[model samples]
Every structure is written in C-alpha cells, then in structure tokens.
Target chain A: MVMPMDGQLLVLAQAETGNALGETAPTIEVEEVGEPNPLTADEQELHATTEADGDAHHSDVFPPFDATTFGDQLLWLAICFAFLYVVMSRMALPRIGGILEQRKARIEGDLAAADYSRKKTDAAIAAYEAALAEARAKAQAMAEETRTSIKADIDGKRAQVEQDLARKLEDAEARIAATKAQALANVDEIAADTVQALVGQLTGEVSQAEAREAVSQVSKE
Target chain B: MADPNTVDPIHQFAIYDIFTLGDTGISFSNSSLFMVLTVGTIAAWLLLSTAGRKIIPNRAQAASEMLYEFVANMVRGAAGTEGMKFFPFVFSLFMFVLVANYFGMVPYFFTVTSHIIVTFALAMLVMVVVIGYGFARHGVKFLKLFVPAGVPGYVLPIVVPIEVISFLSRPVSLSVRLFGNMLAGHITLKVFAGFVVTLGSLGFLGVLGAVLPLIMAVALTALEFMVSTVQAYVFAVLASMYLNDAVHPSH
Candidate 1:
C-alpha cells in the first residue's frame, strides 16, 4: 500500500531494526540520522538465518494486519474523496468549463454563418429570377419585331408581283384589238373592189346607167 | 516468507481492524493507507510538477505539458475534438487511477486494486456522473441513450428491455474486469511463491521443481505489472466511451 512518505519510512525503520538487531538488544538505538543501529545477539541470528536481501532497509515493510474493523478505512476513503472533490472543483472543472463554453460559442458562430448563407442564397435566387424575367421580356419583344418586319417584306413582294401581272394583261389586250381592226379593214376593201368589177361588166353588156346606179347604191349602203 | 506448512493461513491473511462503532465496523489497514497515499501522491505530483514553470516549458514543465497533451489528444481521438470539453475531468480520472494502480504494484504494498469493492465503487461513480451529465445536457432527450435509430414500433417491445439491461450492466462489467484481473494475478503470485517453499524442502528433485515455479513467479510478476497499467487504462477508456454515449445520445 502507498503510505505517506514520512509515515512508511518510520514503520520500515522499526521493522528493519527488529529483524536485524534483534528485538532483545539493549545497546541498539535507531537514530533518525539515516544509519543502521547496532545489532544484538537475537537480532544477528534472525537477520543471518533469514538470508533475506536485508540491505534495502525498507524490506522490513511488511506489517501485521487484522481484517475485522473498517471504521478507519472508511474515514480515510472519505478524506480522500474530499481531496478529490477539491482538486476537481478547483482546477479540473474550471479548465473543462472554459473549453465547453468556447465550444458553445463556436457552434453559435457556425449557426450564424449558416443563417447568413441562407439569406445570401435567397438574394441570389431572387436576382436570378429577376434576370430571367427581364430576358424573357426582351426575347418576346425581339420576336414581335421580327414578325412585323417579315410581314412587311411579304406585302412588298406580293404588290410587286401584282403590278407585273397587270402590265402583261394590258399589253395582251392591245395586241388583240389591233389584229381585229386590221381584219375589218381588209374585208371592206375587198367588198369595194368586187362592186367596181361588177359595174364594169354591166356597162360592157349595155347597161351602164343601171350598173352605175347599183354601184352607187351599194357603195352608199 | 514463512514456511507454507508451518505458518497459520488465517494469521497471515488477517487484515488489521482499527475500530468498532456499535453494529458498524471500520478498519484501517494496508488498504486504507494506500487509498490515503493515492490521494496524497496525486496532489503532490500535480503541485510539484507545476511549482516552477516557464511560458515556454523546461523539462519539468514539459513533462506536465506532455501529460496534458496526452490526455487532450486521448479525449479528442476517442471522444472527438468536441470531446475537448471533457478534457479536465477525464484527464484527472485517468491520472489518478493509473497512479494509484502503479503505487499498489510496489513490492510488499497492499494492492487495493485486488478488491472488487474499490473497482465497483469507481465504476459506479463514473456511471452515475455520466448519466447525470447527460440529463443536464439533453433534458428529456437523455432517454435516447438506449433507443437506437430505425427501430420500428413492432420491435420496441423486445428491444427496449434488452437495451435497458445492457445500459445498467455497464458498471458491473467495468468493475468486474478490473477486479478479476488484479485479484487473479496477485493470487497466482502468492500460490507460486508457496510452491517454491514447498518444493525447496526436498532434495535435488525438489530443487528442480522449485526452479520452475521460481521462474514462473518472476515471469508472472512482470506480466502482472503490465496488466495493472492496462487495467487502469481500460477503466479510463471505458469511462470516456460512456461519456461519449451520454453526449451523443443519437447513437
């Protein structure tokens, strides 16, 4: 058992003396001066016969024990407990508490960071949505402008085609009218010639006056 | 060292009884002395080690500094960096128990470790304190220490009782491991030493037998020394494990 330093030494010294110098020796006195006391007859026999490593003075540490009572042991245990509590409260717990408080603060700091991140994330999401809406509006306007320009281009192309078709149709009608006038002129000329010929034939057959009248009437009609 | 046959076993085994209080009894013996010594030794060690210090450590300061670092790292590694919060309590418990165990192993010193009562008391203390800490930290949520994740309602009938029993058995198992190891080792040593005496009284054959036990005893003593340190460490580690469970009840 671990004894108090001052204490075990005293018990050890007494045990050594009794074993080495004999319990019966009269001249031996164990001085506190760290020297072995003189040995006596009975002590010398006990020491020699044992043949124990009697050099280490503390070898006499074994003391008699009786196992019946426990009041003192309980008292010692209680006292030791008190010491333990004191050390725990005064030194150990304070260091532990400081570390714990530091940890709590660190956790709170992280939570605050998470909160800040959430807010920042919300702002980023809002800004992205706004940009998306603005982009949609711009695209819609651009599409509408393109559709208007395409409609204008189609209208211009249709008007140019219609003007070309009308010009061709007018030219075709003028040609047809000219051909009909020429045919009519030729027919009238042919009829006048035929009448003249017939008058000549009648005069020759001795009917000049009647033939002349028929020709004039035919010409007039 | 007495002859095995000549000496009375009861006399040799008798532990000193110092007092009586009515129906109660209190004994101051080798065991009691060691307990007192353990407390004193721990106090002196802390004080002397910290007596003179430099901002940047010298040898003595470095020694204590290493102890602190060792314990801090142990807490961080076993419990997690978050375990640093429990650094002080766990460190002190480790140092105290380890030192006490070492002191008990000294030649001719009465080993308080070989007793179940002492070990159980320590285990119970850790169990109680850890539970209390959990309650303080988590309030009603401390009940989650046993209710593991993903257990369905149908399974709760069988699982809850089993978990509760396992939880309560922590102190018993922890104490028994330490007590049984220490007690068995010391008893083995004593028995082997007895054999040396018994066999040595014969002639040459006796001497040969005695030689074997002598060798065995010496070897076992060395083994015992290692076991003592390991047991102390085991106790401390278990304490930390229990604390971890308490803090992280989700597990």
Candidate 2:
C-alpha cells in the first residue's frame, strides 16, 4: 500500500511538472501535492523544496513586462528610431531616390537617343533606296537614248546604200538598151551587104542600091 | 523530467544594464545596444551601397534599391500617389522594424523589437502621424473616416461606434502584434532548443532520443526566421494602410 501511494505521488508530481514545462521526468518530487494534510513528512519536505524553487523562479518579473527596463527601452528606441528616421529621410532616402531617378532618366534618354538613331537610319536607308531607284531609272533612260541614237545611225547608213544601189541599177539598164539599138542598126547594114554579094556572084553585077532597096522591102514585109 | 535550472526559457529575455546614468533612471542596456546596431546597419547599407550611384547597380546596390522600391510600391499601392509625401516616414519605420527583427535572429543578440515598450512607441508614433496629418489636412472632415458613406441612417449609431472602437484599437493591435510575434517566436525557439539540451544529458540512449528535439529546434529556427520577415512586412503594410486614412479619410 505504501509503495502504491508513493507511485501515485510520483505520478502526480510528474504530471504537474510536465504541465509546467512540456517534458516528462521523475525527478521533480512532490511538485504540487494536492492533499497537503495526507502528505508524509518526506512528501512535505519535497513540497517545501518545490515551493522554494517556484519562489526563486518567480522572484524576478518576466523580463518583457519589467517596468524598470521600460525607461531605458523607450529612450533608446526614441534615439535610434529618430536618428534612423532623420538619416533616412534627410540623407539616405533622398540619395537612393536620386540614384533611382538618375537611372530612370538615363534609361529614358538612352531610349530616346536610340529611337532617334533608328529614325535617322530609316531615313538614310530610304534616301539610299530613293537614290538607287533614281539612278536605275536614269540608267534605263540613258540606255534607251543610246539604243535609239544607234538605231537611227544604222537606218541612215542603210538608206544611203539602198539609194546608191538603185541609181547604179538604172544606169546599167540604160546602157543595155543603147547597146541593143546599136546592134539592130548593125544587123540591117550587114544584111544589105550580104544580099549585094550574092547578086554580084549569081546574076551579073547588080546595083548595091537596088539590092539594099529589095532587102529593106523584105524587112518591112 | 527536465531540470528547471537548465531549461529556464525566460532567461533570454532579461535586460541587463551595460551602464547607467547616475540617478536619472536612464541607462544603456542590451536593448539599447541592439537598437544602435540596427540603426547603424540600416544607415550603412543604404548609404554605403549607393555611394557609387552607378547607372547599373552591383548586387548590394540592387538589394538596397529593391528594399526601397518594395516599400515605395507598398506605400503607393496602399495610399495612392498623393501619399508619396509620407514616403520617408514610412521607409524609416519599415527599415527600423525589419532590421531590428533580423538583428534579433542572430544568436545571443538582443532583439530590440521583442520589447512591448519599443513597439508600442512605434505604433503610437504612426497613430500620431495619422491623426495629425488627417486633422491638419482635412480639419473636422477627418472624422468622416468613422462614418461609412453607404450605411443606412438607422444603423449609423451601431456602426459608427464599432468603427471608432476599431480605429482606437489600431495602435494596441499594431504594437501587440509585432511584440507578441517576436516574444512568442523567440520563446518557442528557446523552449524547443531547451528540450534538446535537457534530453541530451541522459547518456547514450538520451543522446539518441535528443535527435528528435534537435530536428524540431532546427525547423523552429527556420520558422522563426520566416515569422520575423513576415511580421516586418505586415507591420509596414498595416502602417501604410493606416496612413492612407490620413490621406483619404472618407472611408
């Protein structure tokens, strides 16, 4: 029975200790003996020890709530925070803000410059293309002019050669006509001579005039 | 059972004086040291990083610029373009709280924002600015913030008081939110870390069992870091929203 009672006391003590500090142990003897009157002298002594420990622990106020530290904390907080506020507002913040502002301005300026450069480049390219197109058109016109002039020169030379050849052909036709008329006249004279020779050889000498007259009459018939 | 002496979680929050001014009750303490460090760090980071003022920023300059733009955009988004007048004030508050919270994350370093007085003062400062700016800018028209435009006339009484109450509780909530987060997060981390120490003392078996708590402590440390950053951002966002009321108090 005594052993069981001791076991119960140990269990109660352990339970209380565990509640105070979320860990279990058998070492905290009789932390809060619920029934003080039923306690043995040994249990009472253990309770006294536990009470002393609790007093020692609670003697100092919880540090967060300690009124004595309030003045110091408030003073330092004011000094540090005010100093920080002033430094930040007056010096540090403005500097950072300025840096950011400058960076933004620089970026914008660079972008604007880039945009201007791009526009200039576009204009230059457009100008170059325009000049190239104008040059191409000029070259086409010059080539057409050159070809027209060359064709006119060739046509003029061909017309002169054709006129010379036609004149030469007409002159040759006139000469052939003249030659034919001369040959016809010679043929009449030669016929008269042949008839006169035949008459002289066959029927006694006849008059040349009379043979010519007969031949002429035969040609007319 | 853990030894109470070895696992006293609240010991870390204690403030001890480094030097005290004679009889005036003003003393330099650990909290003061951290506050100074916080301000110094912010100043140096902002000032030194941007000293070059390069058109293209280096890594440090970019980081500083990002912090500036982040807070700037938040103020603008919450309050609008007219609220740019309060940019410096909002920036200061954001940096101080953010750097102080991060400073607290370093081991063995005091957390300036974990104290209720410090956060309360900051919240009050914000409220004062809001009220002062609202009244200065709009006169009695600032009271229009409490009166909703679309509310039916019969429900004005109930709705107005509720708005007034919520408006009055802003500083309390603001201060407590940051303080509580910092205090509770630090306490939780300390408690979990204490478990590892307490469990690791029992011998080879205890060492093996301690691994679980050790893992928990590491995870909690990561959670605490997130909590610190998030609390700082929340504080800044809320302050911006409140400042918006000063700029446009017509609900």
Candidate 3:
C-alpha cells in the first residue's frame, strides 16, 4: 500500500516539477537579464568543475537573506514538522507514557503487597509467641499441682507405717511385763519348795501359802 | 583529486534539483532529501521501537523512552507540569534538530539545521504556538505579558516596550543560537577537513603536515558532536520556557 502511494507521489512530484520549471524559467531569465539561457551553454562546463564557480556561488547560510529559498525551506519544514508533531503527540508519546505508567503502577502494587505480607508475618509471630507463652504457663501450673499431690500421698503412707511400728512395740512390752510377773511367782514357788525341802530335812514340815506370802514379802523388799 | 583552489566549504549547503521540471532552480534539493530522511528515520524509529511495547525496555525502546523522559523532564522543569501538554512538540523539535545536526556531521550529509531559515521557521513556529496558546487560554490577559509585574506607573511605558521587544526577540534569539551553533561547528569541521585535503596534495612531507589538520578535524568532529547535542537541548529548553510563559504569563 505504502509503495503504491509512494509511486503515486513520485509521479505527482515529477509532474509538479515540470510545471514549476515552466513557471520559473521566464522569471529566472527576467531576474538574470544578462544571461537569458543560463541553463544551456555553461551547464556541462559547470558540471565538469565540482565548484561551478562561474556565476552562481554557493548560497551562504549565515545570512538569512534569500527570501525565495526561505519560503521553500519553511514550506517543507512546516510539512515535516507537522508530520513529526502528529506522530509524536498521537502515537509515540502515548505508547511510551503508557509503558511508564504501567511500570509505576506495578511497582507500587508490589510494594503494597510486600507491606501487607510483612504485616501478616508480624501478626503470625505475635500469635505464635502468645500461644507459646500460654502453653508454658499451663505447663508450669500442671507441674505445681502434680508436685503437691505427690507430696501429700507420700506423707500419708509414712504416717501409717509409723503407727503400725508403735503398736507392735507396745504389744511386746506388755507381754514382757506379764512374763516377768509370772517368773517372779514361779520363783516364790521354787523358793517355798526349797524351804520345804530344807524344813523337811530339818524338821520334815512345808506350807505353800506360807511360802507364797514369804515370796511376796521378799519381792516387796 | 579535486582542485584545492575551488574547495568551497559553503558549497555543501547548495540546493540542487533532484529531478528537473525543465529549468526550475527550485526543486527537491539535497536539503529536501535530508529533511525527508530526517522525518522518515524518526518516524521509523518511533514506530519500530514501540511496536512490541514491552514492559521491560529493549535497547531501541530504552533509547526512545530515555528521549521521552528527557523531554518530559525538560518541559516539566521549564514550564511545570502544565507545560507537559507541549511535550510532543518540544520532543519533535528537539529530536529533529538533534538528528539533523548529527546527520550533518557525516562526511557528505547536508546539515539541515545549519540553514538559518530552517531554524528560524522552527523558532517562529514555537513563537506562534506559544502566542496562540497564551491568547487562547488567557484572552486579553495574555497581553499582560508585556506589562512588568511590579513596575511603577511612571516606568510603565519604558518597561512595556522593553518587555515587548524582548518577547519579540525570543524567536530571533532562539533561532539564531541554534543556527549559529550548527553552522559554525560544521563550517569549522569543513575548514579543517579542507586543510587535510589541501596539505596532503603537496607531497610526502605535506602529507605528514596534513596529519595535524586531520587530528584537528578529528578533535573538532568530537566538539561538533557535543555542540549538536547541546544546541538541540538548548532549543528544546528554550521552547519549553517560551511555552511556560504562555501557560503562566506574568504581568
């Protein structure tokens, strides 16, 4: 499409050039006055020399004096400038601006997300700390309760053992006392028998009551 | 191989018809060719670079983006954010001038911006646009630009004329500055290049002497490159400044 249009433009430009030359030829002659057909004779000779230093010198760009060329330059500059301005304003700039804006928004979005995630992490840490602290406190209380109950159970068992030991000792002591009394009574009887034997030997006479009374008196003494 | 006597540095600026209509001196010349070249190159660049329109910038995209940002910053700095509406214009003008200036640095390429008429036309366009914008937006208030903000009543006459003259001179100064920079730099480069050609034709000893001019040309070429870029920047900056005045005309 563009190629076709360019070709069309080329044709149009050629046609326009023909018309322009026809239009400007008489004017160029009138302007020169001395050289009517300036284009004919010296054209090849001038081409032979690179400088073409005969009549028309190179246009000095320093002085902005050439009104004719100025108009032409301005005409083209305007067209070119307008074309550029349109491209820049309508197409190029907006695309760039869009990319830049999108990038900016993306960056801001990422930053915000980061901030939110950081907050979430902070909350999680706080929750974890709180839960850990609570668990520690519960464990400490449970330990205290277990220690107290265990101590009570041990105390009750120790007291029971002590009472049993005391009871056994009392029974043994009572029995020994009874045995001692019995032994003392037996000694009286034995002593009376001995007395009777001795009496019998001496006079052939013995009494159990008297013996017992005597044993009692001896035990009292 | 050409005659050194006939070596005309200013001949590079001559206009010749590409295809003659018959005898019209005014036909599509080298200047026109380069102008079209300038337009085509820029258009292709902008179109191609932004074609993919990726979020991550490629080299061409990055270059275009950088240029955009640079021009955007210039407008924002000079004219504030309001001046950004003129970004496209300023950017176009800057790129065109910059590209044309750089194009001129090529050995045989014609420097379009070297012509005073071209720069003046651009400057006039800026002036026209600014004035049009100012008047369109501000109405009669735009004329207040000629009035100094805090001038005494007795000094109003003197101050107003001076302000008006300065305002009128804005385009002239802007155009002349860019035109002068490009023209001078290119001419200087040409002169040095001419020196090399002229001196080298003499003999072996002369060829050795030509080395000095060749070095100078190389150095001047570097300077011209800088000048080209700076002039473009200055033109854009000045345009923005003028546009700023339009947006916010101080009485």
DockQ of each: 0.08, 0.31, 0.34
Can you write out model 3's per-residue Cα lDDT over B1-251, one digit (the tens) per residue? 16774566666666554543344343465677788899889989988998988888899999999999999999999999898889899999999999999899898788899888899889999999999999999999998888868878999988889999999999999999998888778768888888899988899998999999999999998999999999999999999999999999983
| Candidate 2 lDDT for residue A55 | 26
> Which window of 10 residues has the lowest lDDT sum in candidate 3 chain B?
B17-26
- Which candidate should be chosen as best, given lDDT against the real structure? 2
Each prediction's fraction of true contacts recovered: 0.20, 0.71, 0.57
Candidates sorted by lDDT, best first: 2, 3, 1
Q: On residues A34-62, what C-alpha lDDT tens digit does candidate 1 reach at each position?
A: 33434333333432233232232222222
lDDT (Cα, 0-100) at A196 in candidate 2: 86
B-chain TM-scores per prediction: 0.86, 0.96, 0.95
Q: How do the residues A53-110 of candidate 3 rate in per-residue lDDT, one tens digit apiece? A: 2333433221233333454566578778889889888888998999889989989999
RMSD per candidate (Å) reads 14.2, 10.6, 8.0
Model 2 bad stretches (over 4 Å): A1-59, A195-221, B1-5
lDDT of 1 at B184: 70
Highest-TM-score candidate: 2
Model 2 over residues B1-251: C-alpha lDDT tens digits? 14633677676676777775664545678889899999999999999999999889999999989999999999999999999888888898888988899888888888988888789999999999999999999999999999999999999999999999999999999999999999999988888778788767777897899899889889988998899889999998999999999999997
